[model samples]
Target: MSFATPSLIDAARSVLIVVDIQERLCPVMTDPRGVLFNGARLVRGARRLGVPVVVTEQYPKGLGPTMHDILSELGDGASSAVIEKTHFSAAAEPLVRQHLESLGRRQAVICGIEAHVCVTQTAIDLRAAGWEVFVVSDACSSRRPESLTAALTRFPAAGVVPVITEMVLFEWLADKNNDGFKDIMSLVR
Candidate 1:
């Protein structure tokens, strides 16, 4: 008998996907500030642990670019890619699918805006495509609180694991003795 702990995220096998937390979109979310702060924390922690990141901007022309806070964290030193998408599901975008496939990581750590729309669709699609999907609950939001609740409720049936920011950080770190422990801990603090 083989027991595999699929719920645990390994830094080496993970990719962080920041989805459509765009400029125009942020201000209208149920909890914009909290979402951005937690999303940024995830991005910062991912970089500290050498996890690759892919950021998607949904319909950039209409929605505007990724928020400044998230972009700022990516910086020059971060291993990250930005994809402009029109599809609600980032996984439906050919470029996004290709890029994710190229990374060769099976686990995807996702966070972003419009929880009932883009975020939910992307998580479902990614899970269907065989990626272990973990959506950061606090780092995702919708224009209305109920929509956010709906999205989270749908995750389990979709095979998408709903997780918190700290869960992702610690799982990626896996041990307190890791080199980036102090740096990543600051994000949690």
Candidate 2:
């Protein structure tokens, strides 16, 4: 995947990874509502597109659980694997690696909290592990805007693509005539 150009994120070869959108962490983020709303929407879109999802909660005991809205969107853990971890990067966890290997997908669409920490590290690590990473900017936040900016600035340099929620949805669809177009389009709008 060329960091200088747009890489095709084929749904057939993609997985949606949402990192640390936990209950306690949500309120402290710079764009709490935007992050959660877009993150939840991304989950719905991923399900609609038949893309596997891996959601991680960083120390759920301290962070509280994954937020209600996101958990509800993810459902009763029916389709997505919800992993718990202490590592800043979910990619560093054994379970996350297992999911990635089992899914056998090359592209990862990432959304979550604390852009400068867990989310950024996971994206970088995933890229290093030979996965094409796309970090959804609107769905990521930090307590300070500067931190988000700093991480985003390093994304392309690290070969991780920084994108938005809608881009992932549309790119995964890659066509309007497909069956889930309206459903995915509604989530983006």
**Model 1 lDDT on a 0 to 1 scale:** 0.91
Clashes found in each candidate (C-alpha, N, C closer than 3 A): 0, 0
At residue 17, what lDDT does model 1 achieve?
97
**lDDT tens per residue, model 2, 1-189:** 454454788889999999999889999999999998999898988888788889898998999888987888876545588999888988999988887789878888999989999999999998887888999999999999999999999998888899998888888899979899999978866
lDDT of 2 at 102: 90
Misplaced by over 4 Å in model 1 are: 1-5
What local lDDT score does residue 26 receive in model 1, on the 0 to 100 scale?
A: 96
* lDDT, residue 41, model 1: 96
**Candidate whose TM-score is highest:** 1
